[model samples]
Target chain A: MMTNPGNKVTQGQFSFLPDLTDEQISAQIKYALKNHWAVSVEYTDDPHPRNTYWEMYGNPMFDLKDPAGILLEVNNCRNALPNMYVRVTAFDSTKGWEAPRMSFIVNRPPNEPGFRLLRQERDGRSQGYSIVPYATDRPEGERS
Target chain B: MLDAIAKGTAAPDESVDLQAEFEASNIDEVMDKLDRELVGLKPIKTRIREIAALLLVDRLRRKFGLTSGAPTLHMNFTGNPGTGKTTVALRMAEILHRLGYVREGHMVAVTRDDLVGQYVGHTAPKTREVIKRAMGGVLFIDEAYYLYKPENERDYGQESIEILLQCMENNRDDLVVILAGYKNKMDRFFDSNPGMRSRIAHHLDFPDYGVSELKSIAEIMLGEQNYRLSEAAAKALEEYLPIRMRLPHFSNARSVRNGLDRARLRQANRLFASRNRVLTKTDLITIEESDIRGSRVFAEGKLEGEPETKAR
Candidate 1:
C-alpha cells in the first residue's frame, strides 16, 4: 500500500466533442456533453422523422459514410448525449488522415427534456406505488 | 347673389360630382371611397391614420437620410374574426404605398401552412420564398399562434420562425409585417418568442362594433349599392340587428353585411314576382321591416325571431 492517497477514482471533465471545427456546432456539442444532455440530429437519408442520441466518448470523432460508400472523417470532439444518431454525409478530412466525411444536418427534437420527462412521470404515476407499514412492529429491532 | 347664382345654374348638377372630387384628393379619397364600401370602423380608421402618418414620417426620414431603402413598420393587430382585420390590412398596404413607404402597395396574407414546411431541411427555403414574395410591401400572418406551438419537437414551425426573425432583421429597411389574430392568442404568441415581441413595436386592437355602428355600416353598404332603407325598416333593422348581433357567433360588419344580403335577396324575390322590371325612384329598392322580421329564406334555428339577448 502506498503512503499517499493514490487509489482514488476521479471522474474526468466530460468532453462531448473536442474536435469539431465549426464553432456553433462545437459549442452546442460541448454544452450537451457538459450537462450529460441529449440532442436530436437527423441521422438518416431516407427523409424519415428519425433522430438518435450518441453516448459521448473520450473525444467525439464521427466515422461518416455516404450513400456512395465514401468514408469521411470528423475529428472535432464536442458534447453530445449517448445514443443520439446525427444525420451526417461523408466529406473529405482536412487533416489528411483518411477521416470519414459527415455534414451537419439540422437538429430535430429541439427540446430534449420536454416529452421524455412527461412520459416518465406519467408511467411512474400509472404504476403507482403501494405504501405498507415497514415491519410495523419490527420487533423493536428484535428487542435490541 | 352668389346663392342665387349657385342654385339657378340648373342646380349646378347638384349631384356634387362626388366621384371627381373624391378622386382629386389622396388619402382622403381612399378613405372616402373605402367608407362607401366599408362601414362602421371608426376606431380602425383612426388607427389606420396613425399608421399612415408613421409611414409618411418614416418615408420622409429615409429621404432626409438620403437612403434608398424604406423602413419596415412591424405591427400586431389583435381581434376576433370578421372584425375587418384582413380588410384593414389590405387597405393599410395601399395607404402605406400612397404615403411612399413601399414601391408597390401589395399585401401578401399568409397562414402557418404557407410558411412552415413539412420536413426539416425544406423550411428555410420555404419561409424565404414567402419573405421574398412579401419583400416590397406588407406580409400579414393570420392566426400567428400556430407558428409557436410548444408541441411537435420536430416542429418545422420553429424553422419558419427562425427564418422569419432573420428576414425581419435583414429587411427591416423594406418589409412591413403585420401579425393578426384573436387578442389572447396573439398575446400568447408574442410571449412565446422574445424576438417577435421585441420587433413588433405597434399593437392595434379592433373592438367589436355595437348595434348602432353595425346599423350605420349596413346603411353605408346599402347606399353604396344604390339602395336605401326606409325609415321604419331602418328602425326595425336597428332593433333587430342589436339582438342578432348580441349572439356570440355573430361577427361585426360581416354579420351585418350577410343580413343585408339576405334582405336584398328577399326583396329581389318579391320584386321578381310582382312583374317589376325596373325600380322607379319612388319605388326604390328598400329594406323593409318584414325583411328583418325573418322569412323562409333565412336559415332555420338561427337567432332570428328569438328573444334578443344582450352581449356581455
Candidate 2:
C-alpha cells in the first residue's frame, strides 16, 4: 500500500520517517531477536492517538530466528490489509514490565486521511480538546 | 515501486518520531493524591516515598546503561485492621503504575476464599485464574495469613500458595503480589511460607493511628461530608478514640468512621425534630455538643432530647 506522505498518521517509534527499508527493518528485527524479544505483527484500520491496542495478526513469533521470516509475515499482513495500518512490535520480557518496548509502523494505505481536533467549552473558562481520527469517523467502506 | 522501496530507499536510523502521547504522568501527582486521601500514617507514607524514589532512581540508572536488573516490585503490608493498609496499597499501585513499574496500575484485592477452593483438584485452576486476571496489575491478598491452615489437614491453602509462588517468580514481569495482614500473623505467615518472604521486595508497616490522628481523621471525614464538629464534639472524640483503641474489635480509622456515622445519625434526628422551626443552612450542617454521642457518653448516664445549641 502507498500513502500520501503529508496525510500519513505519525505513530510508533520512527513514524516521522518515510516507510522503512527492508534492511533497516531487518536490523531492528535482528536486534529484537538478539535480545530474545518476541516479535509480532499488528494491523488496525484505526490509528487514533488514543488507540493503544491493535489487532494482532497472529500469535507472537517467539521462536523466530531469521528476520526474513518475520519480514515475510509483515509483508503478508500488508498485502492482505492493503488499506489498513500495519506495525511490527517487539515485546521484551527480560524486564519485569511485560510491555512492547519497540513498535514501528511498517505499512499504510495509499490515501492516509489525518485527524481532526475537537474542542468543547466546559464550565466557566475551562475547555477540553480531543483528537479524533478522520479516517475512523468515515464509514468503513469509504475509509480510503 | 514496491521492489525499489524495499531495496534501500529508507534508512531506519534516519528519522524523526512522533512524541509519544501516552507517556505516564508525573509520579508526584500520585504522591499528592496519597497525601490528600490518607489521613495520618507518617511511617507508611515515608516508606512509600522512599520505595518510589528508589525505583525511579533504578529506572534512570537502567536508562543510562549504568545498571540493569529485574527489581522486585511485590510488597508486604502488615498492619491492624482499618489502619489504612488497603488504602496505602491502592495508592502504591497507582504510584507504581504511574512510575511505569506496573502496566495496568490497578489492584485486584482478594482473600483466602478468593484464591483457595473448598475442595481438592480445584485450587490450582482457581488460583491460576485469579493470577491471570491480575496479570497486568497488583494482586492484593488481604489477611494473607488466613491462606494457610496447617491445623486443618484438608485445607488447600498451601497448594494455592505454591501455585502463587511459581507465578510470582515466573510472571513477575507482569504481575505483583502483595500479601497483607496483621503484624504478628504476617510474621508467622512468612516464617511458614519462606518462599513468599524472599520474593517480597518492600515491607511497609502501618501503625495504628494515635488519638490525635484519629481525631483529625474524623474531622477530615466530617469536613468532606460538609459536617462541622462543635468544640464539645471534638473533645468527645479526643476522649473516645483512646478508649476505643484499647478495646477489642476496635479498628482505628474504621472506628472513627463508625463514630462519625453515629454522630451524623444523631444530628439527622436532632434536625428532624427541629424541622418545624425556621432552620438556617448552618443549623443543618453543624454537629452539636448533644449530638457527640461517643460510646463514652452512651456508657455514662446522659440526658438526651435536651434543647441546647452551643456552636463553636
Candidate 3:
C-alpha cells in the first residue's frame, strides 16, 4: 500500500493507516466498550507530541454502554474542529494503568503540513538540529 | 555477539558473497540508526560494529562447514547515568533480531528492585518472571551492581543473580543479558562475581557527552518540540553547560532536557508579561536570550548550581 510520510499522524495505534471508515471506528469502539474501557473523544489544533493534551470534547463516556453515542460525539468533534486534529482514546480502568490502552486518530486536516528536520552543522562533523513544524509558523487559529 | 544470521548451507561448489550477505542482513540500517540517534559513544559503537562483523564472518564460516557453538551474547554496558547505555542497548537488540540472533528485537529494561524481591522465596520468581518476559530479546539491567550486595550475609540479591546466571548460561541462543552501570562499580562487581565476568564476552563503556554533545542533544529536543533558540539564546545555553556540569546531580542529556524545558517556561512567562504587544511567529517559536538568562545560574556571579532561584 502507498503511504504518504508527510501525512502520517503518529500519535496513536493504526495511525500510519488511512483514515478509518465509520464501520471500522465503530468496530474499535465496540471492542473497547466490550473490555470496559472508557472511550473518550479529544481534538486539538496542535498535533505536536509535546502538545498532546488535546481538549476533550466531553468528559470520558465511561458509562455510555452504547457505541453509537461515542460515534455521534466523534462526528460532532469532526464537524467542530474540521481544520484541527481529532482523536479517540480508550482508557483502561484497571488500577495503576496511567497510559491509555488504545488511541487512534479519527480525523485530520486535509492540508497536513508536516515538520521539517532542520539540521545546523555546528563544529566539525557534529550537527545541531531542530524540528520546525511548518504550519505553526502561522498563528494557532490561522494554522491549517 | 551473535552466532546465527545466515543459517543452513550453501551448495558444495557454490561461493557465498560477503557483500550479498551483509546487504541481506539489514544490519547496516541498524548501525545507521545507532549513529543517528546516539550522540557520543565512540567505543560502544566500534564494539557493536566489531561484534556484527564477527557474526557475519561466523555465518560465512558456517557455510564452509566450519561450525562453532552459539557465542555468549551477554554484555556489560558501563558508564555514568544518562550516558546512552539504554539507547545503545535498544539498537543492539534490533541488530541481533535482524541478524537472526533473536526472535524479537524488543528490550526489557529493569533495575534491582524489579528483579529482587524484599523477602524470602520471592526473588527466584521475580527474576524468572523478568527473564521470561525478556526471552527472545535483550534484558538490560541498569545499575546492575546493585544486584550483588555482599555486605549483608543473607541478601536476596544473590538469589536473583544466581537465577540470572542460570538463564544466561542455558538460554544463550534466545536471550541476551546485559549488565549496565557505572564503570568503577561494574569493575568491582566483576571482581566479586567472577562467574558473571567470565560469562560476559564483551564490555562496552559509554562515555559521557561533552558540552557540545549535550548542546546538540538539547537542540534535538528543541526540534522535537517545534521550538528553537535565538542565536544569542543558543550561546547562553552553551555557556550554561560548563557551569551546570560543575554543579551536583547534573545528568548529562537528561539535565539538558530539563534545562530546555525550563527555558521554554521562562520564554512563555516573558511572552505573557509582554502580551499587550502584537507577537510575531518568531516571538512565539524563538527562545530569546533573556529566557535562558533567567536561569538562577546566570544570576550567580560566582556561585553555580546552588538551587536558589533568582526572585524575578
Q: DockQ of all candidates, in order? A: 0.01, 0.02, 0.01
Model 1 per-residue lDDT tens digits across residues B59-139: 433323434444447888898777888988898788776766654567889999999988768777667667755765788
Candidate 3 clash total?
2
Q: Residue B229's C-alpha lDDT in candidate 3?
A: 91
Fnat for each predicted structure, in order: 0.00, 0.00, 0.00
Global lDDT of each candidate: 0.59, 0.78, 0.82
Ranking by lDDT: 3, 2, 1
Model 1 complex DockQ against the native? 0.01
For candidate 2, what is the lDDT? 0.78
lDDT by residue (tens digit), candidate 3, B94-171: 899888787666788999999999899888767766775676688999999999887986999888988889878877
A-chain TM-score of every model = 0.22, 0.89, 0.86
| Alpha-carbon shift of residue B146 in model 1 (angstroms) | 2.5
Task: Mark the regions of model 2 whose C-alpha exceeds 4 Å error after superposition.
Answer: A1-144, B1-25, B294-312
